[model samples]
Target: MKISQISVFLENKNGRLAEVTRILAENNISLKAASIADTSDFGILRIICDQTEKARQLMHDHLFTTRVNDVIAVRLDDRPGSLAAIMTLFEQNRVNVEYLYTTHIGQEQRSAVVFKVEDVERGLSILRQNGMETVKGF
Candidate 1:
């Protein structure tokens, strides 16, 4: 129900993002999924990879500021309204979603949503009780 994610703080400048990707790629780290949110000065790069610990260490060794956080991932149908239904469920259950990102495509006709909620355990339980399948490290 919980997976490790590395959040890399990056400067908003040319080659910054590419440099990060290069560092990971050169080290043979494969990113399963990634999201980036930036402002005027910096950005937060969230990445999901199998070698999470190694990724974090590598980022640190490169002098990049990084933090590891636990997040929940759930599998959902690819059809329309699937996301809305889950959002409705979360809303009804009062689960505060900090942030969320989804995989472009998943096994067959499914998609995976990775999220950080205020109460991870509570949110996970709600998802499980609703018969939602949770994804493990990927």
Candidate 2:
């Protein structure tokens, strides 16, 4: 139901994103999914990595502004109506999605949507009742 997400604060200037990626690459942290939310002068890089704690520690050691948060990652069918169905479930339950990203897995067309929901447990239960699976990384 709950997963960890790393939010790295970066300036809106050039090379800022490159710096973050370089650091992660140097540390061998695999980014499974990522999204950037920008404001006027800065942006929050929300990232799901293979090794979250280590990535956080590495960022801290490098003096990168960052925060760790709990989120939800749901696997959905890749067909056209799949997303609609999932969103309908959440809509019916009034689950607010703060952010979301998706990626394909293996050979299957089905995709996994990583999201930050308003209510973790309730969202999980709603998804459970609808037969949706949550991906939890160790």
Question: Model 1 residue 102 lDDT?
Answer: 92
Model 2, CA-based lDDT: 0.84
Give the worst 10-residue stretch by lDDT in candidate 1: 103-112
TM-score of 2: 0.90
Superposed model 1: Cα runs more than 4 Å off = 104-109
**Which residue pairs show backbone clashes in model 2?**
none
- Candidate 1 is scored at a TM of 0.94
lDDT tens per residue, model 1, 55-77: 99999999999999889988877
Tens-place lDDT digits, model 2, residues 67-110: 99888877776467877888888998899988787755444545
